[model samples]
Target: MFDEKNIWDTFRYGDESSFKLIFEQFYTPLFNYGHKFTVDDHIIEDALQDLFVKLWKNKDSIRETSSVKNYLYKAFRRVLLRKLSYAPQVVGFSSPEDKLDFNFQLGHDHTLISQERLQQIRQSLSDALKKMTPRQREIIHLRYYEEMEYEEIADIMQLSVSSTYKLLYRAIETLRNNLSNTDFLLLLSLLSLKKV
Candidate 1:
C-alpha cells in the first residue's frame, strides 16, 4: 500500500518530489472540500495555490504527521475559512444564518426512470437534510459523504473526537426523525455511494 505518512515525512524533510506528489494527490480533494464553503472557483484555486506555496516555503518547519490527509485537510480548512471570511456573501458550512445547501440531485439518463419518481427522491432527501442545522448537515457530510473517520473530521472541523461522534449521531437522529423508513434508506444508499 502507498504510505502517505512516509511521503509526508519525506516532504517535511525538504524533498521536492514528495512535495509534488502530495500536491497532485491532494488537489482534487482539497478543491472539493473548499467548494463546500464557496462556489467561487477563483477562491478555491487561490486557496489551493496558497496552501502548496506556503507548505513549500515552510516545509522544514512542518512536523511529521501520522495522518497526512487529515493534516492537509486541517491546514487547508483554516486557509479556506480565512479567505471565505473576507469574501462577501460566501457561506461556510457551519454558518447557521444561511440555509443548508444540502444538494441531492439525481442525474437522469435516457433510461426508463420516471421524472416524477426522481423528483420525489430529490425532494425527500432535501427535506430530510434541511431539517438539520448547517453545522449538523456539515458533520453528516464530512462523516458520510466524505467517508472520513471521526478523528479526521474532528481535526478538519476543529472538534474533539467525542464531539464528532455526538454531532454525527445527533445529525443522523434528526434525519431519522424527519424521514420515513423507505426515504431514509434511499437517502442513506445515495450517501453511502461515496465509499464505492
Candidate 2:
C-alpha cells in the first residue's frame, strides 16, 4: 500500500514516479465518486483530470497534515463544486437514468453477479441513490464506502464534526426507510461477498 505522506513528500520533492503512483491509485475511485454527482462521463473525467493536473502543478505549495485520500477528496469536491457552479447547463439536468450504467459498473461484483442479476441490482441501487438528496448520498459514500473519518469528512464537507455525524445518521435512516429489506440484504451480501 502507498503511504500517502510518503507519496506527497516525493511529489513535493519533484519525483515523477510518485505522481504516477498517486494518479494510478486514485483515478478510478475518484472518477466513480464524481459520477455520483453527475451522469455526464465527460464532466467527471474532465474534473478529475483537471484536479490531477492542478495537483501536479501546485505540488510544492500543497500542505497536508492529514491523509492524502482526504486531501484528494477535498480537492475533487472543490473542483466538482466549481464546475457545477460554472456550468449549470451542463450539470443541472436530473436524469437518474444517465448514471445507471456507470453506477452498475462501479458497484457490481463480477464473482457474485450473474449477468441478469447484476443488471437488476445495479438499476435498483441507482434508483435508490437517485432518490437521496446529494448531501445525504455524499455523506453515506464518504462515511461507509470511502471509510473516511468523521473529522476528515467534516473538513471536506465544510461542516462541524458533530454535524457530519448527524448527517450520516440521518442519511442512513433515510436509506433504511427507502430501501426494502431485500435490497438492503442484497447490498450487504454483495459487500460481504465481494473483494471490492
Candidate 3:
C-alpha cells in the first residue's frame, strides 16, 4: 500500500527517493496549474525548476504537512507569481495581477452526447469562462478542475475562505448567465472532478 505522509516525511528528511516520488507526483499538476497564469511554456518550466530546487535545498527545514499536494500547490504558485512579476509591462497592465489572463476549455467524454451538441456546449463554456476575471477563473479551476476545498484554495490564492466562496459564486453565475439551461446542466455533469 502507498503512504503519502511517509513519503513526505522521508522527503523532508532529505531522502532522494522520496523526493523523486514527490516530484513525479506533483510536476504535471504544478505545470498545468502554472499554465493558467502564463502562456510561455519556458517560463513555466523555469519556475517549476526553481520551485523544486528551492524545496530540495530547504527540505531539512521544511515542516511536514497534512496535505502534501496543497502545500506544493501553494508553494509553486508563489514561485510562479514572482517569476511572472518580472515580465515586461504591457499596456493597461499596472501590476502583476493585471498580467493574469486565464482561459480554459471544457473537455467532453461520454459517447452518448452528440458531437455537434458537445461542440456547442464547449463553445458556450469557453465563452462564459472568458467573461470571468483571472481571479475568478483561478478559483473556479481550483474548485472544480483540481477538486480543491475552499480552505485549500483560500490558502493557495491568499484569500479568506469566504472570499474564495464569493469568487466561485461569481464565476458560476457568469457561466449560468451565459450558457443555456441545458448546457449549464450539462456543465455540472462534465465538471464532476474526473479521477486522474
Candidate 4:
C-alpha cells in the first residue's frame, strides 16, 4: 500500500500533496539523524527547511534514486556540513563525541527478559558504547538503529563500502572486548529490534 517510488515520482512532478506526505513521513527520522551531527535543535530545523526548499526548487534536475530516503539523507548531510563549515570555531569541536550524542532509544519489551536484567544490560552496553569513538558510535546507530544497509550507511557517511564494513567491525569488536559474553548477547538482541 505504501509506494515510495510513486510518492517520489509525484513529488518530483511538483505535486504539493506528495511533498507534504514525504515531509510528514520522514521529518522525525531526519530530525533524529541530524541530531547525531549537532546538539543545536535550531540549527537542525533550519537545515531541514533549507533541504526541503532545495528539494522542491531543484526537483526537475534531481536524478532518480532507488531509495528516496537515501537521496534525502545524502542531500541533507551535504547541506548541513556546508552550513557548519563556515560557522564559528566553537561549533567545530576537536572530538566527534562532542558534536555527536549516543542516546539509543533502547526500549524495553519485557516478554523474555526481566526488567532488572534488561536494565543491567543497558547500563553495561552504555558503558561499552561510551568507549567507542564518536564515528564508531555513528556507524553503529546508522546500521542498527536506522536499520540501514552498509552501502547506504557508507553513502550517508561519505565512506567506501569496505571502510564502512571495517568501521562497524571495529566498533563491534570494541564492544565485544568491553562487554561480557552475556551482556554482548543482550546488546545484540537489542540491536536486532526494528525501530518503532
Identify the runs in model 3 with alpha carbons over 4 angstroms from their true place.
89-113, 180-196
Off by over 4 Å in 1: 91-123, 181-196
- Each candidate: RMSD: 7.9, 7.5, 8.1, 7.3
lDDT of 3: 0.79
Q: Can you give the lDDT of residue 71 in candidate 3? A: 91
Q: Write the per-residue lDDT of candidate 2 for residues 1-196, one digit (tens) a residue.
A: 7898888888878899999999999998898788767777888888888998898889889886568888888889899878877887875335454454433354545687677666665666666666667788888788767888899999999899999989888887765665675477778878988956
A best-first ranking of the candidates according to their lDDT comes to 4, 3, 1, 2
Backbone clash count, each prediction separately: 0, 0, 0, 0
Q: In model 4, where do residues sit more than 4 Å from their true spots?
A: 89-112, 180-196
Comparison by lDDT, 3 against 4, better one: 4
For candidate 1, what is the TM-score?
0.72
The candidate scoring highest on lDDT is 4
lDDT of 4 by residue, 1-196 (tens): 6588999898898999999988988899888877766676777788899999999999999776799898888888888777776665535323344344556455657799787777776766776676787678778878988899999999998999999999999999988887776566767877886443
Each model's lDDT: 0.78, 0.78, 0.79, 0.79
The C-alpha TM-scores of every prediction are: 0.72, 0.75, 0.79, 0.79
lDDT for each residue of candidate 1 in 167-193, tens digit (9 for 90 to 100): 988988887776676566667877898
